[model samples]
Target: MSAFARSFLKKSLLAASTLLLGMPALAEEAASASLSNPFICRRPSGAAGTITEFPLPTEESSPTSITVGPDLNLWFTQTGTGTIGRMTRDGAVTEFPLPTEYSIPQKITPGFDGNLWFTQLGVNQVGRITPKGVVTEFPLPSAGSSPYGIAAGLDGNLWFTQVTGNRIGRITPAGVVTEFPLPTPEAQPTAIALGAGGKLWFTEVRGNKVGAIATDGTLTEYTVPTANAGPSSITLGWDGAMWFTEQFAGKIGRIGADGTITEYALPDANSGPVDITVGPDGALWFVELRGNRVGRITVSGALTEYDVPTAGSQPAGIVFAPPGFLCVDPHLWFTERGSNQLGRIRAVTVP
Candidate 1:
C-alpha cells in the first residue's frame, strides 16, 4: 500500500481503538456552562453586506458541521477537539466535550425531541445533547459505521448516513437504532437531507448516485448523468426539488421526485463543492472547499460565487439562521475548517 493510504489506515484504527477503550474526562466542567468570551469580529456596516468571523476558544477546533438548534442557537461539531459546541447569535460560545475520546463528531442536527443529534464517526456512535448541555450517546449496531450526515426525519426521528458501512440508519427519540443496507455495495453514503413527500434523500459519493429512502425503508437510487461526479451533499431546494453538490465534477445537480436528473457545471473548474442548503431568500447556497468561495445557484441553474475573506478557508458547512430571537434578518452561517473560525455572510442579495 502507498504510504499515504497506510497512514490513513493507521489513524483510523487508532481512533477506533481510542473510542473502544475510552479516555479520561478532559473538560467535564465546560459541558454544563459556557466557555470563555469568544473573539468576535463584526463588520462596521452592520448586517447589510457584512461578514463576521468568531474564533473558537480552543485552537484547531476544526468545526465541521453546523445546525440551528431549537433554542435558536448555532450548534456545531468540533472534529479536531472531539467536542460539541454551541454559539449564540451574539457570539457567546460554549463547548460540551464528548464522553468518548477521538470520537470525531461530524454533522449535527436538531432532533424532534428538543435536542441536537450528531454523528461520531471515529467511535461509530450517535450523540445527543440537550439545550441545557446534558449529553447522551447511543451506539450503532455495526462496528466501523463511520456515520457522517444526519437530519431530522419527517417521522419524528433522526436519519443519518453511514459512509463506511454503506447504509442508512434511523434512531428514535428514545435512542433505538435501525439500519438499512444500501442497494449498491460500498456506495459510501455521505450527506443526507429530508425531502418533500415524507422521504429522505442522500448522496452516494463512491457509487455516483442519489438515493431516496421512504420512512418505511423502501429504497430507490438514481444515477447522476456524469460519471464519478462525487455527489457529496444533498438538500431540499426552494422549488420543491432535491438539490445536491458534485464535489469531484465541480457541478450542482437537481433531481425531481420522479428521478429526473439535471446537472449545472460550476463557473470555476475544480471548485470542490461540498455542503449545500436553501437560503432564506429562496435561493440555493453552497460552499466551495477548493475554490475558497461560497456559491448561490438559482432554481433556474443561474450560478454566482462570493469569495471568502480568508485565503484557503476551506469552508465545509453552510446553514441559514432565520429571522427570530437573535437575528433580525436571515444570515448564512458556515464553518471555516481551514481557519478555525465560525463565519457568517449576512444580507446577501440573490440574483
Candidate 2:
C-alpha cells in the first residue's frame, strides 16, 4: 500500500484495538487529559475522525463563533464570560474581556483593516479587537438592536444582522454606523453573508424568508417555502450560492444568485442545525446544537454525520484552520458549548 494508505491503516487498527479493549476512559478524557495527544480517531478507516473535549481554560465559557484570524491563530467569542479568546495552532489559549459589561459577544470575522470584528448581542453595539487585544466598541443608533451575525463586506465595511431591531446594519472601519429597516417588522434577521455581486444575504428567523441588501441599501426578500423555518445561520457555498440552516424546520436551504430556492431535509429529525461554513474539502459543514453532532452536506445533496463522543455537548461554531499555519492535513475546528471544549475534525475527505 502507499505511504498515505499505510499511515491511515495503522491509525485505524490502533483505534479499533482501543475500542475492542473497552477503554472508554481514554476516549472520554482524550483531549482534556492530554494536550500532546488530543486526537482520537473515531472511524474504522481513520480517513475521517474527531478530537473531542479539547479543554478551554474558562469553564462554562460558552464559545459561540470561531474564525481563522489574520494572525492565523484561531479566535472565538465566549458568550457566557463576555470575552474573546485566541488559541494557537499548538493549543495555547488567551482571552480578552469586552469592556462593556454583559455585552454578550456573538459572531466574529477578520475585518479588511487587519483587525477582528464581532457583534455584541446583549448591548446594542459592534466591537473591534486588535491582534494585540485592544478592544473598541461602537454603539448602534437604535436601542436594543441585539446585533447577531456579522461579516466583512466588499464595500470596505462590516455588515451585520440586528435580531431585535429587525434591520441590517453597516459600520465602517472608522466606526461610522448606518442601518436599513426591513420591510417586515419583527422579522428577526439572524445571520448575514456576503453574496455575489457585492450584495449581502441574510436569514429572517421570524419572518420565514431570506433577504438581500445591496451596498447602497436596496433590499430584496424571498419567502422560504416552509413557514416558521427559523433560519439561523448562513454561508456562501462552494457552488457560489447561499446555503443556510433551518433551525426549527430541520432542513438546509440553498438560494441561487438568480433568486431560485431549494430546500433539503435532514435525515435526522430535529437536529437543530445552527452554524455552517464551507469546509476545506469543499462540502458544507455545520453544527447541530440540539442533536450533538457535526454534519457535512455536499452540493449534490449528499449528507454524512460524525457523532461527537460527548453526548449533549452542543457543538457550535466551526471553521477550517488556515493552511500552513497548522497541520498539513485539513481539519475543521469547532466549539463544544455544553462541554466547554474546542473540538477538531481531522483528515476529512469526500467519501
Candidate 3:
C-alpha cells in the first residue's frame, strides 16, 4: 500500500479492533511530527450511533466555525449575533458577544495562550476570547483585508487569511500584527492551518492553489491542477499531507509536502464540502453545506457519509475534542449555520 493508504489502514484496523474487542485504542492524530499531538483515538462510549443538535439561545446566531476550546468545551462564532459562544457537551451554552458590530467571525482555533482566537471577516480583524468569556478584538493594519480563516501557529502566534486583502496575517498574543503579501495577487486565501515543518499552510480559492509560509515570512504557492477549484478550508491529514475542499470542483484535494496535488471526487457532484478536520480515528471528516451531510474519508479516498438530521441545516465546521478532554465520550462536533444549532456525531458513529 502507498504511504497515504497505509496511514489510513493502520487507523482503520485500530478502530475495528476497538469496537470488536472492547479494548482501548491509541492512534496518532498529528499532521507534522514536529508538532505536538492534538487529539487521539480512543474507544468511543455513548448510547448509539446517532446525531444530536442543540439550538442556539438567540435567533439567527449563525454558528460558523467550531473548536475544542482550552476548557474542554465547544466554542464557535455566531456571525449573525456577533457573539462567541461556549457550549458543554450536554447542550448548555454561554455566549460572549463581540464588542464589534456585525463582525462576521469565520474560523476559530484554540490559542496557545489559553484562549480561543478567531477571524472577523466582516471587520477585517481577528478577535480573542479568554476562557472566562472576556473578548478583545484586534484590527488588521490594512483596511479591507477581509480576514477569514484563523489558526494557532507553533511559534506562539495566531495566523489568518485575507480573502480580499490577498495577504497572510500573523498576530502576536499581545495583539501586535504582521501581514505577508501572497505572490499571486487576488489569491483570495480563505482558510489557514498549521502543516508539516511548522509552516502555516493555506488555501487560495481564486488562485486555484495551496500555499505555505514559514514563520519568518518566506512564501511558497502550488497551483491546483484543476482550474478554479475554489479550494476553501484546509486541514493537515495524518499522512503528513494538507487536505482541502474544492468547493467549486465538488472534490477534495490533497497536496503533499513536495507540492504534488491529487483530487478525490465526493459522492455527490454538488455536495459543496466546505470545512474539514482530522477525526479521532485519523480519518478526515468534513461538512457538506448544500448536501446537508457530514463526510468521512480515508487517506486512500474511501468515503462514508452520514446525513444530518435537519435537512438543509448547512453544517459549517467540524472539530474533534482535544486530547485534554476526557476521551470516553468524545465526539466530532459541528455547527449548523442554517439551523442556528450546534450538532455532533456520536463517537460511536465516527470511524
- Candidate of highest TM-score: 3
Clashing pairs in 3: none
Instruction: Highest lDDT: give the candidate number.
Output: 1
lDDT-wise, the better of 2 and 3 is 2
For residues 137-242, write the lDDT of model 1, one tens digit per residue: 9999999999999988868889999999999999998889999999999999999998989899999999999999999999999999999999999998867899
Residue-level error in angstroms, candidate 1, position 290: 0.9
| TM-score, structure 3 vs. true | 0.86
Using lDDT, rank the candidates from best to worst. Answer: 1, 2, 3
Tens-digit lDDT string for candidate 3 (236-286): 887889999998888998999999999999888789999998775667889
Q: Report clashes for each candidate as comma-separated counts.
A: 0, 0, 0
Residue-by-residue lDDT tens digits, candidate 2, 186-286: 99999999877889999999999999999999999999998889988899886789999999988989999888889989887599999998775667888
Model 3 residue 274 lDDT?
Answer: 95
Show model 2 residue runs off by greater than 4 Å: 1-46, 325-329, 347-351
lDDT of each: 0.83, 0.82, 0.82
The candidate 2 region of ten consecutive residues with least summed lDDT is 22-31
- Stretches off by above 4 angstroms in model 3 are 1-49, 322-330, 347-351
